[model samples]
Target: MNTVTRPRILVVGAGFAGVECVRRLERKLSPDEADVTLVTPFAYQLYLPLLPQVASGVLTPQSIAVSLRRSKKYRTRIIPGGAIGVDLKSKVCVIRTITDEIINEPYDYIVLAPGSITRTFDIPGLTEHAFGMKTLAEAAYIRDHVISQLDLADASQDPAERAARLQFVVVGGGYAGTETAACLQKLTHAAVKRYPRIDPSLIKWHLIDIAPKLMPELGDKLGHSAQEILRRRGIDVSLGVSIEKAGPEEVTFTDGRVIPTRTLIWTAGVVASPLIATLGAETVRGRLAVTAEMTLPGQDGVFALGDSAAVPDKAKDDDSAICPPTAQHAMRQGKVVADNVIATLRGQALKPYVHKDLGLVVDLGGTDAVSKPLGIELRGLPAQFAARGYHWAALRTNVAKVRVATNWTLNAIAGDDFVRTGFQARKPAKLKDFEYTDAYLTPEQVRKQVEGTRALDQ
Candidate 1:
């Protein structure tokens, strides 16, 4: 008797792209045709756009983290691990499991969607003293840390120490940075009312960016509108400046200004995952270069998309332009990649990925927001409605949408109680603690490790 083997498809990361791809593949392919496997460190798909709300205690972490096992159509074998390296020659990927075990996973078709990491410069003391907003834990930790600062400032008798503890500096004026500052500033502003000893004026927030304008993608009019809203709310908006040096209790800027603050939130930007470099493939601006069909040039059955791939923007009619890294693009690209993969398996024609630009939205916390959807600029409650409405619709699961909406409604009526969850007291939440960039193996190391594992199995 002869038996047929099913083709195995391996996807790395469980971000928006990886999760969407797996969901589509499960719907399209029968069990007999193909087997799907997802490699990730967590069992949930994190809703990243609302991370600022999580940090500000507006939403619970579980509300934004949609579980992978919730769907009845989920047939993919979930491997609780993160891919560290891929050996293109051997068609194997090295993964570091949550328990720190190393294993090599071989595949017939591979999808790289590992996503980007927090981009950091070589400024002194940055890695040691700064906090990142990339992960769920980071957001939760930031909430606790912000509250604890208030608790400490109220108890301190020394004026200098109290001021240092009260002053907060947020670097980066992008969407993440801007929202983080806006949300957390509201958090501090509300929490200070409880501390009768600590005057609200002592709690200062400084938002600085190297760019000349804020949310420049929103155009000059709306961007300035966001700046004015923040300014009126008492946030010091500084443009065309950035951090030159960082210390434990103070930071110096390139403009030769030093501010004392124990909290320094870094949301500067992101770079493509280092895992892409392990494949020894061509890359553009640190992202894996791919054709319009989202396939590598010479590597068969290998594909890349999302933040890790520099996919060409066919809509612009410019060969030099690639799609910008955003949740909107990543989610759509995943569906297209899944279709193309099915086409490859069925011996059909592949489709090129092209999308029209959806305008940007920035939620500045509370009733202040700025948005430009389909080229019509809006602000105040109308913009806030559009911003929240877009995110509420974009949430993947219905349960997530309901939970997020309830949280928003409750927060508006009840307001935050400013309670510290004591997450930071158990473990220090710094940049180095969250991201494990050094956990992956090199290409040479992957080859040797896989060969050794095979020898042991034999």
Candidate 2:
């Protein structure tokens, strides 16, 4: 191995944690100190909370995609690709770039924050039929798909076909599924007016989940309030039931009822990135087990955080309790990890990750909303105001904040045009297509890649 000169720092992923880590590193580290590089499939940090709005045409894709290059403070090297594997012993990361070129990148210190993927179950035809809401492309494609359904239903002469096209099902009643159902239902409710041939009464949006309660974290009263809001909007909210089987034309629910619909959105939960498995490390329910300091236990110069790491919550005083995978926690965890990385370089003490819960927000696509900011419950416009206010403040950049604010203002005043972008037309829109489940390399493959690169070097 060549003698080390300046320390090389590499951060994986572009989600809240990875982006914030890179930003803070660039801000804190001097030019002559350490060279920082970021590896990600996209160059933007997606604001996940507002993705339902994107799919419903309330916000443009760029409005929620916070660009990493927009940083005026420091310029970190960008590798436009997704990381596949890493060899901690050799300090090398295997990456598949935009052009599919496989390159081995070496680093002195590496941060693994590759984020999570859309969690799906073993239900039949789930991947083939359901659509995801994780990425910007998926969100945009869903908008087109929903609009196309309306058009197809309007032009169909067959009664069964029209009914199938107009009926939509969204699984998982948590924040993602509930908000998605609410926003998209509102879309169809408004857009059907433009379809003079189609009867608005035929339009149906059902939100279902296996859990007994909807957003139980919001407390009973607030959860019920949110459920009432959706119910009043004509949404069929079903609980304690899930999909028994998913088919192209219909879905059989666990409650022994079959619903005919062409659209199925899956937003149940998330699992850590498949890259986590390549490390062959101990995982807590699929997430890499990490200390309170967010470091890989017993692995020097390696770190993990975000949704991919099971970081113990020091403030909670519970050993089994780990920090929940939320954007708020991820963002704060990123800064702490960055500081620790800097401290490691300076031979200083490492601090554990700890913080109080800032609460949760669920925007139901209008003045109807619910929030629990710092244990205080809110509902209706007060909750809406509190929710949006909190999100607007949490946005990392001024430009992102302005774009989001403008989109909200325009969406409210002018309303959605109900026009499809058509960019995703002729494209396969399904869960299997969007989730890169098979992208990661095996542990042996990671070792081979690094070894092969070293052989060529020698």
Residue-level lDDT tens digits of model 2 in 1-458? 88668899999999999998998898899988999999998888899999999999989999889888775665788899999999988889999998999999999999999999999989999999999988899989999999999999998989999999999999998899999999999999989989999999899999999999999989999999999999999999999999999999998899998999999999998999999999999999999999999999889999999999999988786779999899999999999999999999999999999998989999998788999999999998999999899888988889999999999999999987788888668878799998778878999999998998899999
Tell me the tens digit of each residue's lDDT in model 1 across 99-152.
Answer: 998888999999999999999999999988999999999999999898989988
**Per-candidate TM-score against the hidden true structure:** 0.98, 0.98
Would you list the C-alpha lDDT of every candidate in the order shown? 0.92, 0.92
Against the hidden true structure, what lDDT does model 1 obtain?
0.92
The alpha-carbon deviation from the true structure for residue 383 of candidate 1, after best TM-score superposition, in angstroms, is: 0.5
Clashes of 2: 0
In the predicted model 1, the residue pairs found to clash are: none
In model 1, which regions exceed 4 Å deviation? 424-426
